[model samples]
Target: MSWSVDNTADRQVECDSVAKQVRSWNWIVGGQYRLVDMMGKGSFANVYSAVNITDEADLVAVKISHEGCEDTLVAEAKVYEKLFGLKGVPRARIYVKERRCGALVMDLLGPSLGNLKDYCGHFSLKTVFMLADQMISRLASLHSRGYIHGDLKEDNFILGRQETIDERTVYLVDFGLAKTFLLTNGEHIAPKTGLNPCGTLRYTSLNCTLGNEISRRDDLESLGYLLIYLHRGDLPWILAESVVGGDEKRRLMADIKLHTPVKKLCEGLPDEFFAYITYCRSLRFDEQPDYARLRLLCEVAMRRLDYEIDGIFDWTIRLRDDLEWKRLLALEDVF
Candidate 1:
């Protein structure tokens, strides 16, 4: 199925029903986490907003696998462990396997870039540049750890909550599809073909759609598409959504992305955006990406536009205004 936003009210109703059933059993995970509400749901797992009753009631996200899907959660937890202490990666508190399912507890984060984009339609160039800098840094860290985030999409990158030191920091989450591209001996894995595409079709790389084995370059290519989407609010291949059949749709998307000129794709945006995509798509299968240079492209764009490297983002301003409005309403009620 295509990646579309579900009706929030309907989803919440279903989540509430499941929450009630789980609460009735008085299930306490990680010895002290009590699931308070459902935060999100996936094909094989559901994420709950929980509180650590034994740790000063700190909030955390608890991901529990559905029946017969325990292995997925367990494997994802292992990936998180490998990414521990890495900037932009969330810390996994604990992972436990019960008779029925597996659960992983991690630090809670705020709304995703996708959610913020939906709230504001699109992002300003300054906001996109700031995000590009952090996102490239995050990818560089993951690549250094020998892992590649196979799924690089807007929904996977979220900001830290407000009124905290991390509020300006962006965190990458959902590593269930992450894979190691480097072997133990420090050699890169050889490229292979005839593999099924593994990420969201909208942001997946052209190489991936062509059944080629995913590598570091493919990850970077996907990130380029994501940045473009964030700036323009859409992509050229979005029309492929109306096509019937998953395989046919993917084929059409790949064709469009392959034939679409970089100049046309990044039309109306800064030249750096076009250059970024061109560089990513030009890398060899096993070549190491120049992460530093990639980040420099964004910096050049920011300077050209006369935008400061300030931590303030479009969403930051919007969120601040929202909070102030709420405070005013509260004072009016009190008076």
Candidate 2:
């Protein structure tokens, strides 16, 4: 649906009170949604396509789990509810029902970026910068609220359609590992470990591998790796080769963390795009770049790439509009 300012108010929902315990949640099936078919499967849950029974016109992705994972399921539901309709990301249309079979409902997304890459091979440099700009803006929005996406990778991003560039929308999905940064008297501290290093290994940065403190910087590192994969069809390290506690893996990661070969991979991209990727990879435990700087870079790169890609004759605009962007960024100030 075309999200406009008129419909934006209807999208905002309170996210404070969701079921915290799974055993306490009642599993209700067939209440308001008719299961269409299985969409995808995760390590813990099965995502399905379903038509909302209450609103027959609406279709959603429902997650079902019946293992000893009630609590985790409930936690994921709560996070999605709170984060649904969040700007720059795919807003979750989440609801929990109590019945014989419990279910969690979320908005459906099209093919993920990983799948897109698999089907279409590599994308142009212009598309990479545009996507990178969108990602940077989304990350900035999440970080401003002190919330870490926890998982950032190609699989979590979806393409809305395959038409013109302006018609395509990159929807950031899956927030099962998301967490809000809690502040005590205005001080920001590191998120504790044991939070399940929640991200794809291929895209995960060295900070996560080292068990170093998790912060916004960790997400940025992964974003950088994703951009590289999208533009160059390669990750900084191979998953099988980058396992923790392995000698070769550790050494290779150490070298990458110390100095990522930005010049080599970003061979044909614009100078600004290279600079942004460099900044993302360079972010350290104590020295993550401020969101303001990243936002500025994204804006500049997006505009530059737009001119280069669109040229003077073509007037096809990107699907992502400024109003939604500005409104989403405004959420940070309130936080």
Candidate 3:
């Protein structure tokens, strides 16, 4: 999970195939990362793995964008800066290299769940349990702080570095579509009636697709889809082909989400899956979800599957030996 290396002239980008989209942003190239290697691109931004010059064993990830996309990165940087001291989120200290181009730097994260899924198919039950617990806890933290991660999908949840205490941790990245669903005074934002689409299509909530303003419930609902996707590797409503227009496709997705029985979607999964969907669906537009209950539900599933709640996960399974990390530190010594 840790990406520090000496003479990183070619430290290599992980998940190159799945995260191949990259563009050259010509600002802040000499600072931050000693070697700015492209990690991958998301729906709207490019990521890079750069060596922190002070320490080869310690590297930082820089996310940059240019032109019209600059504002989204600016907004994302603001969210990271504003949420300082917020655990489970990424590094609170975000540095801006070129404010005009939205070039920014923060602590590097491990592989995204999206890249992992594409490489290894569905996550194991143990991975899902660990991810589900962390995700719900983080979602609760974000909501408690008065923000909705308008975009909640596997790609946004990246693993923490192996060398850090957050090794078992999964940090939720990309606050591009984040919004203050609740006002400063604890009052909800004014309700709207229309389809103002937001976030990724696969995991967006029905309310957001219908043009309604997203709220806490919308985020939790999206989390529901994320959990299912992690469990099954695909959602039931994901169409086989784009036979219809974008609007129509979303309509069918939303309809199938509504019409399809929760039991069917969660056929081979545990009871927690159904509970999550049912609870998310039943939430009033302005209500708070029971974060503890949802996480506890996943805990039950973990027990049913005979997985150790605190066991190391998919990525860290190889680093269990002391020699692995020792070898990494040795590389630092030689450098």
Candidate 4:
């Protein structure tokens, strides 16, 4: 409850348990397009690089279905179709047109945030704040249409370089588990049910992990965790010990499932940034982050990094290219 790091034994148990659970699910490996190479693999699905037969020169990323998750995949495909090419979110180029394999195709964006994280250990406070602003803006757009990005994590966020110039920009993707907020005429139409409490445990918020409620605030909470992780390179709590044994892993998962709140894993950060994270975490079901407030926070963070990281600092506009990306990664490589 106090948000201290976990001991080694606890972490081992948690890891082992997660591994066992993953063994039971069915993972599919093919797609309608010619699968070239695996992009990434998660607990439930696998993303692959493929080439479309209809247009051989064009490339696509196909997400295939797995066992115990066909319905969720279908629902996600529908959401993508409805929200395709909408600003702020990745456009799904193709939905599950061939339902038999349950594959959805989308623009083959470059490496994900996970790849960037591997290249750049943890980001500076300024970079994280900027990313938070972008994520919040995207969330605002989604909430306006009554949808919730149930899964928001590093793997789901994509970063790509422009063709003419290597400018790295962020793009949110992976909606296979996204949820639709059941509403009608701006009022609740019915209570939605049957969706799993899915999402990486560390980044998920207290309300979402427990209450089964989805809202724009839920996305904000996740964004807070994303910022914290980007700055800290660790989850709020220590789990190294839990990864050792199966029983301990289950206990950890159960603790998470029961909504046993973890402390702000972002200790020792600057007060202003930490306060922003706390604000994001505390948002209620109906609450949302204020864009103007977020912009101010970004400005404050940019000022704080005016010395050591000043070379990469540009608070006036959003980051839309790979110069910043290369600089950030270079810092990580050397540091």
Top of the candidates by lDDT: 1
What is the Cα-based lDDT of residue 19 in candidate 3? 32
- For each of the candidates, the C-alpha root-mean-square deviation to the true structure, in angstroms, is 3.5, 13.3, 8.1, 8.7
Query: What are the per-model numbers of colliding residue pairs?
Result: 0, 7, 4, 28
**Which ten residues in a row are the worst by lDDT in model 1?**
1-10
| Over 4 Å off, model 4 | 1-32, 54-56, 97-99, 161-167, 188-196, 240-264, 307-335
Please give each candidate's TM-score.
0.92, 0.70, 0.82, 0.71
Off by over 4 Å in 2: 1-30, 97-102, 161-167, 184-186, 191-196, 239-261, 264-268, 281-288, 295-335
* Per-model lDDT: 0.86, 0.61, 0.73, 0.61
Write the residue-wise lDDT of candidate 3 on 1-335 in tens digits.
Answer: 01122222222232232133333343343464553577765544567787767768767787766434677777888887767677778783455645334566778887788877876677787888788888989889888878888888888888887566766677887888787876778788877876546787678777776667788888888888887888687887777225345666667766877677989988887777888888888888888889999899888888888888875766555445556889999999999
The candidate that achieves the highest TM-score relative to the unseen native structure = 1
Winner on lDDT between 1 and 2 is 1
What's the distance in Å from true for residue 143, model 4? Answer: 1.6
lDDT of 1 by residue, 24-98 (tens): 877788679888887777766788888888875599989887766688788889899999999889899999986
- Residue-wise lDDT of candidate 2 within 1-335, one digit each (tens)? 01011222222211101122222443234566677766765644556777877787677777765443456677766776666566646555555645423467766657777776775577666666667666777777776656778778888877653443423566666676777665765456754543333456566666675545577787887787787778788754564453544445545654665465768656676676567667766765545467667656656776765646332111123223445678889997898
Indicate the TM-score of model 4. Answer: 0.71
How big is the positional error of residue 302 in model 2, measured in Å on the Cα after superposition?
Answer: 5.8
Clashing pairs in 2: 26-98, 27-99, 27-102, 28-98, 28-99, 32-53, 85-91
Q: With candidate 4 superimposed using the best TM-score fit, by how many Å does residue 199's alpha carbon deviate from the native?
A: 1.3
